[model samples]
Target: MRYTSEHKQATRQRIIEAAGRRFKQDGIDGSGVATLMKDAGLTNGAFYAHFASKDDLVANVVADQLREQRASFDSTPSGRAGVEEFVRRYLSVEHRDSPESGCPSAALLDEIVRCTQATKEAFTDGALGVIDEISAGLAPGDPQSVRAQVIAAFALMIGTLQLARALADQQLADQILEQGVQNTLALLPAEDRG
Candidate 1:
């Protein structure tokens, strides 16, 4: 029987959502299309019906993840509160350990750089949008300075999470998160900084 448009859309969404989780948790290359399909309770043969290739699904998943990240950041208040809240939530050991719910930038940075043009474009747009949001949270200042600050903050956030996850000891992980946050806050200007 032919499937309705709504059914097709829902099936496509399920595939994207499953791929997103798998991509974040197991890196793009770590999980195969068959495994992803099985995780979504679908068959590998049905995959092509929704996506032309795994790369296409990867791009879609990246876009979905970016939207989720944007929504999370947008919900937080701007200025110091927003920065503080972001750091607190993002740098925690839980965030470091839980790839499924954590930031996709850190999870897929390497794969993103190597992905197809469409995937790269999606990543670039998502990253720029994030930078713009972070910059807006800063006080009125030199445009260049705001841009630099946003870049620095983004680097710190992702780097700290990576480092925290790398360490063997829980205490070391906690230290990395705490010190990283303190150091990052110090980098901000006295008045407008978080």
Candidate 2:
């Protein structure tokens, strides 16, 4: 039987959502097509009807996840206060422990570096959009310098989350998260009081 266009789009959305979680939890290279199909409640034979290959899915999934993330941050205020809220929430223990729903950059960046050029480009575009959003919180100053600061903070966030997730000791993990929150707050451009 042939599927309707709505059915096809729904199937594609299901595949992408499951792939994002699987990629975060198991790494893109680690997740098998069979497993991804199973997670999506579809048959192995049906996989090709949606995505051309795993690389295509990887590129699309990263773009989708990061786009959703950027939208989530849109409501946050733009200033030192905004960056502090971002740091606290992003570096929290809960965020560190939940790779499935957490930032794709922290969970899959290492793996993304080795993906096809199309996937790499998707990741880069997503990451840059996030950095631009965070840069909005920086104080008025040289655009170049403020942007540099926000980009560095974004790096520190991804790195700290990755490191905390890798550590075995919870105490040390909490410290790692807290230190990132503390340090990033300090580096944020102070609000003008005049």
Candidate 3:
């Protein structure tokens, strides 16, 4: 039986969503095409029907996940309000433990650097969008200063989560998360405080 166009689209979407979650949780190298297809409730033979290759799927998934991240930030309040909220949620223990729902930077930074040029470009575009939003929230200042701060904030966020996850001791994890949050919050401009 031949599948309808809608059915094929839905199947393809399912595969993309599954791949996004797996890629975030397991990294690009960790998720194989066979396992990804199986996880999506489809067989290996069906994989090529939707995606030309794993790289195609990976690029699409990266773009999709980045778009989701951008949407999340956009929905939040603008200016300092959004930054504070973002810092609070991003540095939480919950965010550290939940790789599937967390930022892709912390989950797949290494793999992203190694992906195809298309995938790298998608990641870069997504990251820049997020940084732009954050930069907009900063106080009026030199563009260079704002850019530097934005980079620092991004690094702090990803590094904190990474360290929290790596630490075997629960107390240490909590310490890393809390201290990271405090430090990040401290970096915000005094005028931005609310």
Index of the highest-TM-score prediction: 2
- How many residue pairs clash in all the candidates, one count each? 0, 0, 0
What's model 2's overall lDDT? 0.86
C-alpha TM-score for every candidate:
0.89, 0.91, 0.87
Q: List the residue pairs that clash in candidate 2.
A: none
lDDT of 1 by residue, 51-146 (tens): 999999988888888878877887887776786777788887788889887788888887888999999988878877777776667654443557
Looking at candidate 2, what is the lDDT of residue 8?
98
The window of 10 residues in a row where model 3 has the poorest summed lDDT is 136-145
Give lDDT per model, in order: 0.82, 0.86, 0.83
Residue-level lDDT of model 3, residues 35-63, one tens digit each, is 99998999999999999999999888888
**Listing every candidate in turn, what is its Cα RMSD in Å to the true structure after a full C-alpha superposition?**
2.4, 2.3, 2.8
Report the lDDT tens digits of candidate 2 across residue range 19-115. Answer: 9999999999899999999999989999999889999999999999998888878777766666677789899999998999889999999998899
Residue 47, candidate 1: C-alpha displacement in angstroms: 0.9
lDDT of 1 at 65: 86
